[model samples]
Target: MPTAASSPKNEITIVGAGIVGLATAFHLLAEGHRVRLVERGGVAEGASFGNAGAFAFSDILPLASPGMLRKAPKWLIDPLGPLTIPPRYLPQITPWLVRFWRASLPDRYRASLTAQGGLMRFAATATQAMVAQADLAGHIRADGNLQLYESEAELAAAQPGWEARAREGIEFEHVRGERLAELQPGLSPRFVAGTFTPHWQTVSDPYHYALALFRAVMARGAGLVHGEVTGVEADSRGVRLRLADGQVLNAGRVVIAGGAWSRPLARSLGDFIPLETERGYNTTLPPGAFDLRRQLTFGGHGFVVTPLSTGIRVGGAVELGGLKAPPNFRRADAMLTKAARFLPGLRTEGGRQWMGFRPSLPDSLPVIGRSTASPAAFYAFGHGHLGLTQSAATGKLIADLVAGRRPPIPLEPFRPDRF
Candidate 1:
């Protein structure tokens, strides 16, 4: 059993200043809890800064599905494919890959789907409430997502997943011919079909959205600390966070939302979670880059082109390279080349390329429970690509746990000791 936060005015210290941390701080503050946000870099400076910006409430499927496995082999061969594991990292990644394979089994996949479905449902509701509460509606766009396909075979191959989404009450439309062009003009004739989800929404820009959330937290009396956290220790006295500068701050409780750089902190606290990094790549072009409409997904190719309030951002792929390796910008180049072909009028020049780490678990679910080591410590990391999408829900759930109130959803599927 975990120790209760004890009072409505509990002082909580959260590590990591990304979307997850900001959102967690927002919820805690809503309950009149005092919060101090600690970060090694600027807010939303990591993966949260450059994601596809979709709310993705409809993306309930786990990435470890059989479909992903079928695509992985082909993607692995091509260094710049939608998914790639660096040759040197293969040995280290094998164990995680084995777990991923088991997760893709029919029985396991169904279990994960049920849990993910519940989270997505709660997430959609929680995100709306958060946005409304913070009055950040100006940053949101209701423009739906259009996933493009090149051939009938490709479209046919996607039917099962669509059917699964339908079973979960997600609304979507399958369109071909002129309707495709109407949804997104200037597309190459090669794209024969698409599926549009009308409820999907996006932020004008992910980083700005997070910054808005941070400001909301601050307005409610949250403090911001900038430094690398080297260690976390807890005892009956309280939880203490040690920074690289040899500073220590004690708080009523601590929540770790440290994205891809969180594994070491968790390990030091006695939990051995198999957290890995998916090095995602992208490029942001100038504002007038092809007048991109809503986000466009080239699923078969493994990337997306999104229109942000800042610019037209292009490309995203899973590169299972570790944290230490230098980024291969050619991956960005590859996706850009493909985007130009799909959107005939896309201007590829004058773009800024970026690479960031997305922390992941083999089961494709985040850890959102108290640390098995101590009741005073909690976890809210390993969200992978869905970190931005699920941030608000994770925040609410973590707040519920700290307050000693039963979470709206079961935590069994996201327990810290599950492994």
Candidate 2:
């Protein structure tokens, strides 16, 4: 019997209702294509719901860097440190770690920086245009980010990275003493130097921003399907999406934007990507928790304090535990304790803790090109910590491909089978 694929193949289905998937739907809808968003759970309830809501366009540095490699030994030793690997999952994650180490090689790291910077440049433009076109300007905040350093040594150590950002045309000022105090008051005196990016921006709340995008797409005639996609088969006719309970949907083209859960789907389609889950934990305090003037980055400790409309969010750390592990609220507690000490007046009570997976690639670049198995299918996950920051650009690029137009940037760096 014929299914929905028999229809003129006008509708495009995007898997995952997170920011990436939703943004893709938005762009597809704008291109005059019918759109359907399929999700396994509530929209934005994954990493999108709990992230520190920074636009972070200036953050083009890849996580798999020599700097991070140097710090990994100490970080991995602490069970609740910024980076960790659960004992039981060590064997499973070893392969990904080995790839990560390769990516950290000096030459590869430089290439990644160039690729990331290019994507970020496109992302900044794409985000502005999308926000304006979607009428989401009200939800954005232009407050700068203050990245604090503990001592002169730490600041000096980070100078090269700062120079890299400057070369990329990202504006920032190195500040201290009175200037630093004015930018962010109540900061612990222990922080002797800081880099302030005056143009840095953030959303009022990440989940709310996602909600607004969801509303924008829906208002433009986008639809949603609630199901777990278990199988995908793309043929000359179109693509068929299968849910676990045997329900099937058909679309002319599909974008696999399912975040951390996307690897298996890509594998089923014969694209073996080395995707890993960067499990990040965070704690959100109730409103009035602190007089945070702007986002505060304690980069050395692997966290940031974001002032959200809903609350004060404090968290950032990578737990290399796999998808099925139970929540370790201890990570949240540790970040909160550190936050209180740094802010000197933070109210850590009435805070909510969260854990979520960031789908990551070894080279810190997302897979944003055609699937090796099917031209009708595309891969768009693995943005890692920058998923939200890069969502609109991914959307625009993917939409261009679906429309049979040339993408604005080279997609070779983000191809699926690169690993």
Each model's lDDT: 0.90, 0.92
- Across 1-419, the per-residue lDDT of candidate 2 in tens digits comes to 55554463657889999999999999998988888899999999988999999899999999999999999999988899899899999999999999999999999999899989899999999999999999999989998899999999999999999999989999999999999999998899999999999878999999999999999999998889899999888989889998998998878888999999999998887789999899998999999999999999999999999999999999999998989999898998999999999999898899999998999988889999999999999888999999999999999999988888999888888999888
TM-score of 1: 0.97
**TM-score for candidate 2:** 0.98
Query: Total backbone clashes of model 2?
Result: 0
Which pairs clash inside model 2? none
Q: For residues 1-419, write the lDDT of model 1, one tens digit per residue.
A: 43455442256999999999999999999988889999998889989999989898888889989999898888888988899988899898888899989999988998898899899999999999999999889999998999999999999999999998899899999999888889998899999999999989999999899999988988998898889999988878778888999998778789999999988889877788889999999999999989677999898998988999999999789998888999999999999999988888788899999999999999999999999998999999999989988999999999999999999988899998887
Most accurate candidate by lDDT: 2
lDDT of 2 at 3: 59
Residue 30 lDDT, candidate 1, scale 0-100: 91
